[model samples]
Target chain A: MNHFMTSIFLILTLQFTGVSSSLALADDSIFVIAGKNSSLPQITATDLKLIYLGQKSSLAGKPILIGQNESIQESFYATFTDKDMTAINQLWGIVIFTGKTDPPKNLKSDSEVIKFVNDDENAIGYVSKQPEGDSARVLAIQKSTTTTSK
Target chain B: MDLWKNIVFSCRLFIFCLSLATALATSVASELQINGFGTVGAAASDDQSGYAYDIRNKINYYHDTKFGLNFSSRLGQKWSWASQLLVKRWVDDTFDDNKVKLDWALVSYHPWSDLSFRVGKQKLPLWLFSDYAEVGFLYPWVRPIQEVYGITPLNTITGASLNYIKQLGTVNFELNAVAGDSKVVEDRNGGIVLLANVKRAQLLTFSLIHENFLLKANLGKSDAVDVTQRTGSSSYVFPQLKYTFASLGAKVDYQTHFVWTEIVTTHVEHLSNMNGLYLSYGKKFGIFSPHITYARYWSHNYKSVRADTTTSTATTTVRVLSYVPERKNKQQSLILGLVTKITDRSNFKLEWQYIDADGYSRDTTERSTTTGGVTTTVTSHGNTKERGFFDAHPRGEVNLFSATINFIF
Candidate 1:
């Protein structure tokens, strides 16, 4: 009886933890920034998908370079595109193996992402939406009501 | 041939180094990035069957080795070029003089996000990767399955291509149109002719994403002609759709594959209707990726016809000759392969394939001739039929094992 109760408790606690972590991530903000300090056009989710897919090489006449944490590729897809990590990876495989284009360069952390994006004029990258300081600007929230318009 | 192969190999190396030195020099002078890629490998069929019965009839499948070099460079903002050189033997005798030759050369221009164009000598883009089929680094296998891509004419068109990109609600579409003339080469029947010519091909591809699902399809067509032959023309319509997913670690776990096939179909010309399909599953464990693929190819069935005439008359005797048409050609193969990433920019692969061919017949017709003082009808059809039961090539069934190493820098 005691073992069964312990098992139930463990399961409930793990489930709660998963839900809370997701909720926490939802509360966090994702920042989109350009390589230069010049005012850049706000990017929509649709454009974001295009850039990653290699379908669109540039934005506003400038080539866009996207840098994301290696692990974040899956997380970003799950949250933004409603796709499991596997589907997104497979999509990239098909493109890369076909000799169409190169895969995006992976970075270590959020700070590196900001530095890289802020350094290159044609660069575009992402970070935690709710970052601390004014290092980079948040282009738009993932699937938020306000981001629906241009 | 050996001497020539050595010379060509050295020349290729020299050119490769020269390009590298130039790229490095330019990298120091400007922000432009230069990279190099190549695949150097060899394949030998355990079965002695030649590339075709006519060519391989005397020498068998292990005539010699196959080697190639591919190089590419990025010129500047939106211009690039690439080329390939291949060296192989058609028959065992060096007198046959197998040598190295330029396969393709082209310049690519991308002006905007919505448009890119390529002009010069380029591979006919019949399928998704047909343009880069010989570039092993870009594909998982050492070579494409012969049953499907094998029959596609290996022609280089000198022309231009236009590519367009469009966005739908939740999908992206790539539109491409290519126009050019096919390269001329020696035909299989020891005749000179053009494999493809004055060709125009169009590709329409769309990718869809619904939740974790990914779906894609490509459709294309080509119209070409054989100049040397007597009004020989070629036409093809191919379509392929695939859905893939990643399962373990960083691997594409499954692929749902399908393809439609047809070649030039005409009575007077070379009429061939062949289709191939493959289902593959791949897993990537770090740098090593192992995949097993099952593919099949089949040609349209042909019926045989025979005519006979016998007459005897006292006042008037008459004799006639009749011709019967028949179709008897069928071939299939299965390939298993494993590719390992030796380094970040290098890969090595080993593959084994089983090939089976049947319904091969030699000419057997009778002719009436006058010998001495009497009329006689003689039949001539007594050629030996070679068979391949094991992986050896004396017969039709055989195995092909090959290893290849590719590098990109």
Candidate 2:
């Protein structure tokens, strides 16, 4: 009877832990972030697309610089722009060839992207985790119909 | 002397700017970036005489291959400057001289995301690919069709442009207005030189981009002047020739297939009216993409009249009017090509083109006549001989094959 009771307890503990971990994983969402002092409080998915595609150069009244984390670039673009890394790079080739705009600066990790945004008031970046600091603020993104969570 | 001086000055200025940029890059490193693109291509045609292809081609790399370098610098938060330098051998020249040219040097200001302004020498966006026509890696074909792109004599303009962009839900709209001037020099028949001057050129474009579709419309007008001087003390001037043009274009991309089409009409005062249409379709399969294109060029008859007055011995004046006719021509071409991406930044392309042209040229006939025991010869314009593409050589079909390797860095 004691052995059966211990087995039940182990099974219950495993089930509870699995559910908690899955919920925790689901809560870690990616976000588009900017400097705390930036005038831009929120951005739409269309605006983000234009900014990253080199169609628009600024946000609000300030010229904007774009930084991307290499680790999450594939997922970020796939989820937000409805494109893969190869497609994004091809689009940038056209943009750069036109002599109208330059490609974004690439960062090695999400922390680097956050650091870049924090250093430049006109800079914006994307990361997987919600940044915890006073230098950066997360902007509300109005999702579009095409955007899909990966 | 003035032209040479200007050229030398431009060269010196370019060198100085390049040195300064390099210095700044070494010192700061983060504010400046340099990139480049190049094409090493060779093309051949079945016709031994010549063929008017993109740029120029005669089975040689000197005429078809080109290289370019781009420099971009960020100045503060709202201002930036960029420049591009291109080097290529021209079709009209036997040797590579005057090959180094400045493609664009512009300063851009963006005060808001919706509005922007630019000034300086910039690309005249007359068509969809006009801004990046030289970047072969960005396009599927080895090169754009010459029959369509060759119609415009000017590619870049010196002036300013204003652009406004707005997004509404799933659709995006862009409106662009440009005002500029252009000067071009042409070599006629490889000998005579002609100068074309364009003034007060204005262009307006509107484009709407949706999920997988794009629609664009353009309208432009300009005042053109052409000057031709002969070896003797004779010169001709065609002044204040008005030119107006309009075009409509649409592009669709769905899954692995893409289609692009456009139609253009140009009217030139005291000259022939030209109409052009082009359609292209392509599908991607893994690393390879195959495409086909059809293009047509048509022109209407050109007519001009001149009046001459003569005085007789009795003080009577008579006026005689003479009319000149420039025959019209129609040309069509079919192009098949394949592109394979070697990597993310490089590609290889092979293309084949077949062209058909029909026109008539004036041929002279001579006759001998005897009047009052004297022999005289008379010559008149008679018989029309069939001409080839653009009234070129043997009036028949033309085949061209090209292979190119393009890359961007």
Give the TM-score comparing model 2 with the true structure, all chains together.
0.78
- Local distance difference test, per candidate? 0.51, 0.69
Q: Interface RMSD in Å per candidate, to 1 decimal?
A: 7.5, 6.3
Model 2 segments more than 4 A misplaced: A1-31, A42-46, A55-63, A70-72, A101-103, A106-112, A128-132, A140-150, B1-28, B53-58, B91-98, B188-193, B227-235, B305-325, B362-391
Q: What is the DockQ of candidate 1?
A: 0.09
Per-prediction TM-score, chain B alone: 0.64, 0.81
Once fitted onto the true fold, the runs of candidate 1 whose alpha carbons sit more than 4 angstroms away are A1-33, A37-39, A42-50, A60-150, B1-4, B51-112, B184-224, B227-270, B285-288, B300-327, B362-396
Candidate 1 lDDT tens digits, A1-150: 999999998876654333323332433445566644736588888777667655566777765556766535445655565543434544444444332443454566777787767776567777654445666666656632111100
Docking class of 1: incorrect
Give per-residue lDDT, candidate 1, residue B269: 26
lDDT for B125 (candidate 2)? 79
Which stretch of 10 consecutive residues in model 1 chain A shows the poorest summed lDDT? A141-150
Q: Could you give candidate 2's per-residue lDDT for residues A1-150 as a string of tens digits?
A: 999999998876654333322221232456899987766658877778777766665677556789887766656676677764445766777666665554687677778888878778878998777778765788743222332222
Clash list (residue pairs), candidate 2: none
- TM-score, first chain, each model: 0.68, 0.70
